[model samples]
Target chain A: MSEAKTSANPLFLREEELRQGIELLFFAYRDFTSEADAMLAKHKFGRAHHRVIYFVGRHPRISVSDLLDILAITKQSLSRVLSQLVTDGFIIQHRGPRDGRQRLLELTEKGVEMERQLTEAQRRRFARAYREAGAEAVEGFRKVMLGIVDDPARERFAQSRRDGGRDGGRERDQ
Target chain B: MSEAKTSANPLFLREEELRQGIELLFFAYRDFTSEADAMLAKHKFGRAHHRVIYFVGRHPRISVSDLLDILAITKQSLSRVLSQLVTDGFIIQHRGPRDGRQRLLELTEKGVEMERQLTEAQRRRFARAYREAGAEAVEGFRKVMLGIVDDPARERFAQSRRDGGRDGGRERDQ
Candidate 1:
């Protein structure tokens, strides 16, 4: 039996092994979302609402137009979630200083707290994963995730990094 | 500047680092779903339908209750997707020999083809990521993902593994 296994090309990627990787992605993604979904449910919010809060929290002065680009969702679809968030006092929207038609969004104190709570749960999971996986694996995971982004979105993502906000950390000497 | 940075323990986990990981998960999950969503959109099917088809395809003789358990969705919600898949001839249901009330599901030829197409996109993504990361990171990714699953679902996951479905790659004696 050992010889039979050894006879196969151990280095080669098999179709079956590729299929297992696909199933792992499916199952792993589901597990990742389940925790966040439960937390959102308790707040009478959905995943759409969580996405808005998350991005707004990430970029304090992000405009709705920019948010639409980030989310890749229709304005009409985002409108419902955004309006609720603003109405609920979780997000405060102000007219853009230069672009009157654009609405700038920021989280309120309440919003920040909620965002922190929501993210804390996720962060704990990720931190544990990172610690267990170690630094190299975390780096690899980040690269893999970055590679998965679509070409156009990749450009936007890079631009987001370049246009540093208050939240952006100071440059670390490499 | 260095003194200020050194005031805090650099080796310890920080709020900023934790938040960065949170953002990465949000963005990564979004990118992961986008490929599958585009394909499902072409069929006028949503993620819900895709989930049903995927789990059934992965476990050919999966029961309705078992699927609901795996999906962690309400039966009513799953019924809508399952009914559609069945009506469209993408899935076929059979009565369990041991239990008449239990309905076991399997993909039709059409369903199998559709599942293959949907999963291929994801598989290609994982394949590239795995190869880039190498074996250790892939193993770490799997372990971390399994750890993230909540207690109850973790038990279901373990049971599913024992059942030796496609999700569970048979152990090869090496």
Candidate 2:
């Protein structure tokens, strides 16, 4: 069956292979988030809180609009999570230097600590997978992951990587 | 900075790269699920419903206990989604032939069509990524994704792939 499907498509868009890919993404993601979800539960937080602190830590001084863009959540939805994080002392909001009207988000020391604990669990899992998959596989993994992003967001994703590689000192938390 | 980090570790377990991987997974999974979420929303269904239909579609006649293990959701949580799907004529539950106490789950015609629509959207994304990344990258993508699964689940994941490859006649939903 796999052979027939492969033979039907020179590009190797076999349904069987594609289905496996779909299931792989589903199962792998389920497990990947479980660890961080467990950690967040201990802090009386949820995945939404983890996402807010994570992005803030990664992109220090990120504006609220930019965060909303990244999260693709409604302002009202974000407001609730942002409020919880701020009230819990995990995040700080500041006025943008260039545009005072824009609110910039950042992680406080406590927020940074929470981000570390959450990401540490995920990092260990990723590091192990990277090691097992090797350098070439890692490149392939990156290519596929990048390809999965929507067109407009793909540019932002690439820019973030470049920023992380070059300006490691800009953000002390991440 | 990347060079220094790489040079510092022979295993290539640099924190920077690992963090990038975490973000990649986050961004990719977010985008991937967003497409399906939109489709499910049109049917007045949520992600939980989509997940139940997906796994049941993949593994026909899958036992309730087995599905609970795969989803890792509370019995109450599963009960809610399962009851909804069954009531909506999207799923059919039957007693096990050997053990009458065991409830086996399968997608009805309506359920199968729903699964196909949802999975077809996801498959297009995966196919585009696989084609652009090429076979080697796809191999890497699969390897890394597989490695990320928990130890016990990894075995089930591989078995599912094998099942899909050989027994394509089952359900014909996925």
Residue A14 of candidate 2: its Cα lDDT?
73
Docking class of 2: medium
Q: Give the TM-score of candidate 2.
A: 0.85
Taking the tens digit of each residue's C-alpha lDDT, what string does model 1 give over A1-174? 133333255433355555544555556566666777899999899988988998899778788877887788899999999999999999999887776776789999999998888777777777777777677766555555555556654454453432333334321212
After superposing candidate 2, which stretches have Cα over 4 Å from the reference? Answer: A1-13, A159-174, B1-13, B159-174
lDDT of 2: 0.81
lDDT of 1 by residue, B46-140 (tens): 98888788878867877887788778889999999889999999999998877788788999999999998887777777777777767776665
Q: How far is A13's C-alpha from truth in model 1 (Å)?
A: 6.5
How many steric overlaps are in each model, in order? Answer: 0, 0
Q: Which candidate is the best by lDDT?
A: 2
Top TM-score: which candidate number? 2
TM-score of chain A of each: 0.82, 0.84
